[model samples]
Target: MSERKPQVLLIGFGGVGTIVSYTLEHLGRAEVTVVSRPETYDSIKSGYRIESCSYGIIDNYIATNVVKSTKEGYEKYGPFDYIIITTKNIPEISPVVDFLEDCYHESSTIVLIENGIGIEIPIYRKYPKAIILSGVSLIGTTLYEDTVKHIARDIIKFGAFINYNLDKQMQYDRCKHFLSLYSNDNNFAEYEENVKLTRWRKLVYNTCINTTCALTDLDFGRMDLFGGMESVVRPAMKEVVAVAKSEGVEIEDHVIDEMIRGEDGVYYPPSMLIDVRNGNYIENTVIISNVVKYAKRNGVPIPTLTVLDNLLKLVQLRTGEAKGRFELPEKRPLPEENYQIQFKY
Candidate 1:
């Protein structure tokens, strides 16, 4: 009998998603499909045009199937072996539960290839029997006209949720099966044991530098030139370290210091900053405000993160949900954010 290829479905086909799709399909390891917004659905159906110096450019790669919604996707091509989420960690607009209603099966693993802490809580609550996993993508990628420029090393730290008390061997088997789908030379994917600590480590950089870049409308390069890391980034990084330490994840002083400061005159804008420049809604709640809440519950104060969170909240009030069909509050007390970016959250 011929070996049956593992079937995989990937949701949130953004820059990161595109990178994974091509890598998986090119490997011929899994049957890949993408569930994306309707507007880009047709174009993605046409095929993803990909370009990366590290992994030669390919035009009109029709390797993966593309569909519009999770309902349509599950109806047509699921009970997939794996469903990976590559979108930003924003649960307010579309709760993770919405995607699982008609698609999830206990045997199938759900992989969240995004950032932020506390993301697993909701998924675990809703699908207690399902296998849940997460990844911290260490790549610098930006989308342009169906093309993704992968400028940084494409390394990903993936781990299954052991907090659910699933058999360790079972989880490892599932993780290995999912990890085998990618074969890109540039994409170095690995299994991680300390999932919570890993997420917090990344958060040290994100909650500090990413938040500052978004609030100031500057990229990493610009932020470096203006002494923003010293003036703004350090205090926030230290505050986040405090929160992480409260949660038993000891973030050393040098760890936060090494993360937030980058080489001067580098032009990489973190994802949140990119969202703001494009006049789109940033992942304000997940990366910033939510972390602040986590701090409060643990009795750790994050005054700087709080300030950054409030500032981005104001910025989004003006930037139209530029992504596509993402809606904003209609009747609100706050003025259009274009007035003046105030440090009040």
Candidate 2:
């Protein structure tokens, strides 16, 4: 057996893959291979370049390798120990199945770091023997050529579900392994047993931020203070709480209110807003529709979310969204008193 670094296979060489790969590279312990679409693979293999304000300038054409499809991807550089998926939700599950069918073994671990809630159960039911992990990523990275523009300083949450009856020691071992990868970095990773609850919590935040941001065509900072937009956030949050409560995800009404009031006032743009700005397909299927489905299942009325969902669908239909153009913004301005005050929560 060869004594070599652990091998990592990343599906979709988008922003998430960039950040994860950059981290893995800096950690100096993994051979990272990114599997992208044919068009993207060509671009990456030639040389990857990510121009960003945060990381100064990144050009990774030399180190990174990209291939198309799981079969070719695995054959060229895999039998990977870890597969991290950062694609949006609609096609997320399918490629995972393809990766598993073509290359992965019983020991390979799959980590999903995309938007949406409640996707894991279906994936788990089908791949009962596979090691499945779910996660939330706060780091933002976008692709420019083969390199990824990475915005550091974000937390990542990872773990298995509460309903999973897998061996506790195995779960702990997985957590330990992941932490070993990132623990030394400034931003930390935490593993939880109640990953479902964690997913729902992040979902609520996304439901409010993503829907409103896309519909109103505003980033977080603008919507947070937009008189008309901020007014709608509270009511939307009320509906989210009602639905979440029905689903047994306990979030205090006040905390929900605070989240909306706080996040909106600051200027962090959601992925939906970015996608819309860039003329990409909106992720309405998973975020907006799934919330409505879960609310209906629990007999909880989420009128606000439903209304926003419908409005966003109309916006997507009429405008035909796209991904945001990667123009690095000027330096962030000093926070105003209100902005500073709102973020205290």
Candidate 3:
């Protein structure tokens, strides 16, 4: 008798998906299958290519299997060991429960490698028996044309999502097994005991830089060139810390200084900015609105975040109307708030 390799199914094959798949393949830790869009699936079927600054170039790294949707994937490769979702955390627009409902099994653990806090609540509501994990992704990646590119390296904080609305603990066995797949220094993967606290820490950077750059239609390098670090960026980043504290998640004050370091200023565009420019749905509800929701519930005042939230909602409306992706380049002005203090409840 021989040992069977772990069976891992990822619901997306974009930048994050490709990078994670490559890492898993290199380690020979799992038999990786991908559920991709029609276009991405076709591309993979013909020939899958990945370009990376870290791993050089891989022309054809064969996957175990590639399917178009979760239903198809489940029918073919049912009862996976692990399911990793790399799509955006947009519940209202594109609920994950739709695709992931059939994909999870009794023993399958789902890992989310997307951005935003307050994202797992809905999933917990749908699948009470399923174990979910959050991957606080800090790595820099981009999907262009048909290639997945890894521009820089960072860490992914992994922890179990025991409760929907609150932070607590469950069996650490699954989490430990997942982390053990990678070497200690391989790709900077870490197991986080307090995942919610880590979520808040990442939020300071995402809520501030991602929303601002996304709305302004500017990259980090352009923001540096225009010089808004102390005036705009710092204030926004500082506000996140306050909201996190009100929610009982204490992020050190000095993180603002660390976030403002010079090296972070680069030509890269954050995920939100890329989503907006591509006419894709922005993650306003989960990222910005949820923070405001928690802050108001805790009676914490985040005037700056309030302004940013409102401004973003209005911009999101225009984006929906303009159909930014299909709209002509010239008409879609290469540029761009909302203030609403309400919860999804």
Between candidates 2 and 3, the TM-score winner = 3
lDDT of each: 0.77, 0.68, 0.77
Instruction: Quote each prediction's TM-score.
Output: 0.88, 0.80, 0.87
The candidate that achieves the highest TM-score relative to the unseen native structure: 1
Candidate 3 ranges beyond 4 A from true positions: 164-170, 183-185, 225-227, 324-345
Models, CA RMSD each? 4.7, 11.4, 5.7
- Candidate 1 C-alpha error for residue 292, in Å: 0.8
Q: Candidate 3, residues 1-345: lDDT per residue as tens digits? A: 868888888887777888888787776788788887886677766655777776779887667788887778888887888899888877665777676777878788888887788887777778777788888887877777667778777578888866544334444668778877743444888888788898888888888788888878998667657776676788877778888888778898888888767575457777788888887778888788899999899887888889888998877766655653233334434444233322221
Model 1 — which ten-residue stretch has the worst lDDT?
336-345
lDDT string for model 2 (1-345, tens) is 967877777786676666666666665767778777876656766756665444456655333556677777688877778877777775322434554567676667777777777666565766776677777877767775555666655478888543245776686677668657755445567777667677777777788778888877898778877763457766777777777778778876667756666532348778898888876666776677777888999888777888888887666544332223122225544656233211110
The local lDDT score (0 to 100) that residue 236 gets in candidate 3 is 79
Q: Judge candidate 1 at residue 159 and give its lDDT.
A: 82
Instruction: Report residue 345 deviation for candidate 2 (angstroms).
Output: 44
State the weakest 10-residue window (summed lDDT) of model 3. Answer: 336-345
Model 3 score (lDDT)? 0.77
